[model samples]
Target: MPSSAGPSIDTITEGGRVTQVGEGQEAEESVPPVMTFGAPTAGEILAERYELVEHINNDSAGRLVWRGVDVVLRRPVAVVLRYPGGDSATEMLQAAVAASRVIHPNLVGVYDAIDEAERAYVVREWVDGQSLREMVADGPLDPGRATAIGNAAASALAAVHATGMVHGNMHPGTVMISQEGRVVLADARTDGADSRENDVRAVGGILYFALTGHWPHAEAPLRGATAGHGRAAIPDGVRDASGAIAAPRQVRAGVPAYLDDLTMDLLDAGIAPPPSDVLAAELGRLDIPIEEEPYPEPAGPLRFAAETGDEPSPLASVGGRKVAIGIAGLLAVALVGLLIGISALGGDDDPLQTEPVARPSSSAPASGAAPAAATRKLSVSDVRIIDPDSKLRDELGGAERVTDGDQDKGWDTDTYTQPNFGNRKSGMGVWIDLGEEHTVKSVQVSLSATGASAQLFAGKTDPPSTSAGDKLLFTSYRTNPVGQPFEEHDGTTMTFNGFDADAKYRFLLFWLTALPSNDRGYQVGVLEITVQGS
Candidate 1:
């Protein structure tokens, strides 16, 4: 029988019985062993492919977690086994299956789920790092790191929510941070009791925990407790006599004002939590380097409003910044109006024209003009791969690397048989969102290889961050290219200065028409992209 205080593996006896020892507790005497009749033991093989190696521990819900290996694939795996298959393990199995469908870098990959009459087990990617709960054990994390973890969790949940499914389980335990600095969300328990809104709110809990080393949801305990069953290993949020939990900033020093506002807003029941994607984008924007200030000096506490149909609430709009959620349609309208105004001014040639013009050396306001609208590097709020024709969505994983200010790491397309994406559906590109509209300037793209045919397009509206949305964007942008298309450019660096000086642009699509030949085949890599505008 599993103890009330979560089980920790001390040793596996030859009889296939696991010895449970509590952390910091010493074994004084040889304890009597419990029945091990139906329990899976060390060295047992399930599904003929997964060979159980070591028992990690038993979770709060009496599920056995083992560090296993896929004999066939020769990869380490985490095997979660629950006794008595059938109805008892329905929720676990279902959640595993659903999670398996969504493949994301920040989401732990669910390999296989099986039922062996007496027991049910789920085999998933074995993360080699500690959980958020464990990471914060020493102390709260820095605001930057906490923000990165929040961004990763939110991004993973956004991908999961895109499939119209709720994660139902987003907590410190589920948020895994690997040794390689990879943050992945694992152990989704979509038990139908939780809503998508709840999932979004859980991100707040995660952020709060990361910043304060305290679990906010004390009343409603999350999964994975190192000690007590159902209770989190982390301490509860510092609450007052009124039972109101203190904000992160109040608990920890150096927590950015915007991050504090965002975390508290998500935890606030009164204020609605932004959609996962919107929250993810906001977090991504905040996940900046320590050298750069996270946000403008705070005016007041930021708040979120209930999302109305088609209209999103003002999400993370602090210090008068216009960070509205789901404004793609409105952006499109704004773009259309701008184009019409430009067309009216430009004497009949379609304002939405794609004509190659002489590339300017600089976007600086010509000699002797008002100090050129102080060109600054505009931050990208969000980015996604627009692979409309591809069946595999695997390419969407590293899209963030292109803008991470790291040239060595980048996002690249799969190698193709031919230069033009193996002659498959037009071409694929990256979609970029600049949070809000900005004035005209130049866009610089750093590529890994030269001679790849590419085009830069600026759009008014943002699209849903999905495959279908990618298709719609691809079709729309291809029909009416914004700037001149670069056909077989000579070098890796490409600059587009065709942006209208007076026009304000928000979204951009960097569409690739062809690829450069590599040692493997034909492929192109976007090392880094920088937008210089007001």
Candidate 2:
């Protein structure tokens, strides 16, 4: 039988006995050696520079984390190693390189990424404290403390997004709190799989986990999750029948209202996630600043001798003068009051002369005389995704297609189980920026199928969500149905007329309510959009 040893070490079997082989030792046993795999041990130097000191833990991505030392630089470092290197090292190397480019106080520093044929590893800053995961494991964190950690993470993400990169993997496990109370985000896995919006949501998730001790993104693969496998096991977010996850406050007590709102907004898939920089600024404002304790007040009053003076002592002279002036001021005020009373009595006999009140000037037109402003063609740019159904379709359509005068190609929605987006959402629509606010008279749409219902919404700002059309632009529902359905052969030409012509409008939404097809998975295609305004 052959003795088993780690991949980093060599071993030999000597006649039914297993013996470990040291460096520069020839195999005395005639038996062949068996190969086994394990992590690098102490005194093992990787790439002839990093010496493994001790096993810290395992990362969520099935990587072993070790506390190591850079032999050349003589500095402490944390090394994350993955086995069977070569192809497996691709993502690890890519993540390391991307993270290394961003230098931020809230981001963990990356030193090197190396592959040694048998294994691949990333060397980074060694944080000598617990992960957010470890802290929350004991119990929930204080709301103020959680907010600070969130602010740091968001600020770090803003830096990452500024470079047009996304930190695809953001969980409590990745958030490190050093012994010095420094918050840093580690391990940015940019697989091009998750978008920048996911990064923002992850910050909210972190706060939720810190407060409620529950992971809102339940499917997240966390470190110490499985026994002797990955990292810690993160608890899943609680969801109701509609699949809507409850807010952090609903899950746990002591969560502040402001924090609850912020967390909920980030987690809301319906609304567009606020930009990273904007979110960072908001979090910054909410972060409670550390206050120093105030100095204790003196117990006794000062006892200072008055200076000998040809001129009186400054303090005594000033105090005496102030008292005399105060008495004189009171007498003068009484005399003035008597004179004012006498004048008012005399004015009562004659008509009191008064200045007229002035009215402020106004720029708005008088009632019922508002002119119908001249209209011009508006460009349809700044198209954005507003999928109410939460369908993850990146290639829905562009705003250019609707105004490009191309009947051949236009934007369409993904196939849905039901006609109305499976009742998961109120509706879906494409937003058209009119460049500036206008008096939108009407909008006409050409659809591929008949009887497709839609609405025209005009607003100043982009609609927060698909179902949120009612919240902005107009107080009531904006879903004004198009004209009667036409035959399939002729296609449908529906016009949305009679908009609030006096009301200012900038962003117009053509929201679809019902699909025309009776198929199992149905979708609607808008070929062209004609805007008539004045």
Candidate 3:
């Protein structure tokens, strides 16, 4: 049987079984081996579907990790195998089932969990990337990259937490950054000991490790770091004499103050961390544009008003002296009011001086000048999915839902092998047509995930509702873009507010240049399309 060194073992029992027992360690009782036969050979198919190709390594809990392929789907997968499955592998299978229910772009997709009585296995999405631990093996990551990674991890946790489940396993090893720059979280554990709060705090640990290349010892024990182990793969955080881990800014130069504050607050036991979704939003706001600016403009410290249900006044903490000064200023204005009152008594005699007031004109405005119109939501008369590349046109079915005003349900692209549709096509889009030409003030597109590259376009003519027409429309829109393209937008909601308000537009194309990475592959959901104009 092939065996590899697992996460550092605390004690080897009489039967040579590794048992980890202590605070923060998952409780597992040592049991006799179930498999008396030889280990699985390369290319051996499990469940007659998954064929193991290569062995990756043994995980911290001594489970076998292998690179495999799903024969039916012809897609790569990761297979985890454990011996004596029935009772011992319950937690692993349960976690896999729970994680499979919550799908997010930043989470590893759980495909199948099976127990064959003698052994158990789980098949999941195979990520062609290195773990955060490997990425920072040489040194720390830059602030922008670190922030982006943190935002992705937090976003994934928010999705998991939304389903009322906890990602018990969170650390550097589980945070995978793909070659395509997609950050995803993997390897969830279902131990009853972990909490959602811990999961939220783990994001801080991720940021600290990315920024400083050191894991905070005060945090939950890392996967491989066990008691009595000579040393862990990642180094412990630098601590002061008071035994407190140093903040990222203290450990490294060039760390932003706001980021430093956020990281420390999450790690601080005294300060409660915000909910996962709120934390994700804050991080997304701070994740500066890599091409535009190296550092984001100073965003003040995060205030968790949402969690506390307290909307503090902007001037709640005004000093007494400042308040007194404001009162004096008001009193001075009151005295001036008194003088005005006295002047009003002699108004007829003094012929009170006043500026002329402009009155409304009953006649029409001058020629060629139009009155400014108030913006209102424009009704979309027709909408359709425009996919020129695929002959099947299978992804075009749910186009109407995008303009249905229901964000929960909408149209989505079929999962592609790559972010750019695997080079199969240039792009895909949703073609929207207003009943007639109207001034387009703004177009807001709500997407299901972030990191998609898209652009909005307006054209005079509407093409045929066929694949051939789609090709022509796509070519025209690509050549003539209406507003600025959102390249790798950090948020799911994108507002193209640069439309020419004076220009009349009847046909508009919401084109997606690139799709965000989902657990299955590259895909995106257009939740809703809202157009506001006169």
Candidate 4:
């Protein structure tokens, strides 16, 4: 997923069952269209043709794909790139064809762009299953299905911010979970459209990580702008217009205080809450009332070999790639970084430095070469498992490593303490297991706590009996509003199409209100959890 500007907007992931990052199709293409992560993977089949079917990753900015389609549009279409460097493939094919003429369904469908392959892609609809950050589990959802999946993905971000445009990076792995129970939203990279306060903190962190697994907005206390913000609290050019909201049950408790006050007026209102009518009114509040608890069958996948370490820091791998999220548009360009890489992502310029760099120290560096290390390869011994328990072995820290699969490393309670919902002051949670059944796609957590930070959950069980609109697991969280903890949180590894390969689970949640006055609290550790081998 390149686009650090040496390229336009790279992103595209394949095999986890299709990801996007290839867009820029419109410089009169006969056929040059092909790019995956360096930003621009597919679209403009020019006239029906597709093959590539392999290589599932790249990151000098773009590449990470799979291909195989030939005709009546049978299948294989996930591509999203815009990597032609410093704009122009006609301005990234005019922001992916003005986000494919604002079609809205959680947003993701640009279809073409390739001024002779400088690049641009946007033709997604792949999703097989798994993502909400791999299935979320530190707990949170069912506040009427997290406001019916956050007001149907902010009603497809108010129909792409009402055409003035501005999804500018929402989260929850860009949102997608299809096997049937659809909920899409894909990578919609934007360079402009007034950034609608960064799409209202990416739709209020996509409904606060779909009912709280994590993500509450933090470019580190607004990084440098006091009068303007981008990730979670509307403040730029301004305009929820006046919808006004702020109640997710004061912040979580089995949710439903009128869906936490209509998802806080669909995120501090100003108007916006229609995503397919809030996905049919939070999926019709997915039939509630369940205090019993009894739904098991999760335990899958386990092997272990992981050495695949990487990520010197392109902000430690720009969240995961793809950047146009929604109903299933699925995005991942909101690690929103540049502490020093500068401007390419707001650091303001400097960009990685080049040639096997060095000196950074802790964002990551057991070895070296960082700067989005060409696209983080996943760590923590490649974390073979972290959901409902499926077992895979390696070094694990910060505790809580259960396994209902059998009797290997069964333990629980490494940490969990969500007493308040103030979005800060204190928070903790932990769980991990993946021994047998496997189909999970992604999950990565690493925040030590400048104040505090971390959220990645995937559970069908392990303290999560069900609810959040049952079917097992589905939740997400993102925070770091100041609580630093080495800082390294990403999203959308929460997907589900297969689980209980033996039992899988993993939770590492934390948030410590602005601590010591406005200092907040957030501490993190447990450097890796990279998984993907099919």
Q: How do the residues 1-534 of candidate 3 rate in per-residue lDDT, one tens digit apiece? A: 111111111111213332211112221235222344557779999988999987654443545656789999999866767776777666555555555556577765556778876887766666565667667876999899999999888887777677776665566755667667877665444333456767777888889889999887433333334442211446888887856677777788988765776676566543345567767866786777666777853423352111122232222222110111000000000001100000000000110101110111111235796544534467889999999888888888999999887879999888899999888988889999989998765677879988899988887767897888888888776766764677887767665644553468888999898999978999999998877665
Q: After superposing candidate 2, which stretches have Cα over 4 Å from the reference?
A: 1-41, 57-64, 82-91, 219-232, 236-243, 251-254, 290-435, 438-534
Clashes of each: 1, 6, 0, 179
The residue pairs that clash in candidate 2, if any, are 223-231, 223-232, 224-230, 224-231, 224-232, 225-231
Distance from true position, residue 47, model 4, in Å? 5.1
Cα TM-score per model: 0.50, 0.47, 0.50, 0.25
Off by over 4 Å in 3: 1-34, 218-220, 223-231, 304-534
Give candidate 1's error at residue 443 in angstroms. Answer: 26
Model 3, position 29: C-alpha lDDT score: 33
Report the lDDT tens digits of candidate 4 across residue range 1-534.
222121112222234433332211111223232343343234434224443344333322322333435346566644433344344344444444445555544443334333345443333344455445444433555444454455455556555555564554445544555555445554444445234434543554555556665544332232222231122233212112342222343344555323333333333222222233333333343324333342211111111111123212121112211110112111222212211010011111211111111001121323664222111121221122223221222223324332111222422222323322233323333334444434333332322222333334344333343222211232343321111232221221121121222333333232222211122322233332333322
- Best candidate, lDDT: 3
Ranking, TM-score, top scorer first? 3, 1, 2, 4
lDDT of 3 at 391: 86
Report the poorest 10 consecutive residues by lDDT, candidate 1. 338-347
User: What global local distance difference test value does model 2 have?
Assistant: 0.51
Cα-based lDDT at residue 456, candidate 3: 84
lDDT of 1 by residue, 131-233 (tens): 6666777689888888889888778777667767656555565566766787766544333444666777888888888999987776663322334322334
lDDT of each: 0.59, 0.51, 0.61, 0.33
lDDT tens readout by residue for model 2, 120-195: 6666655466567667878998777887898887787777677676665566655667667877665454434456
Kindly indicate the candidate among 1 and 3 with the higher lDDT: 3
Worst-scoring 10-residue span by lDDT in model 3: 338-347
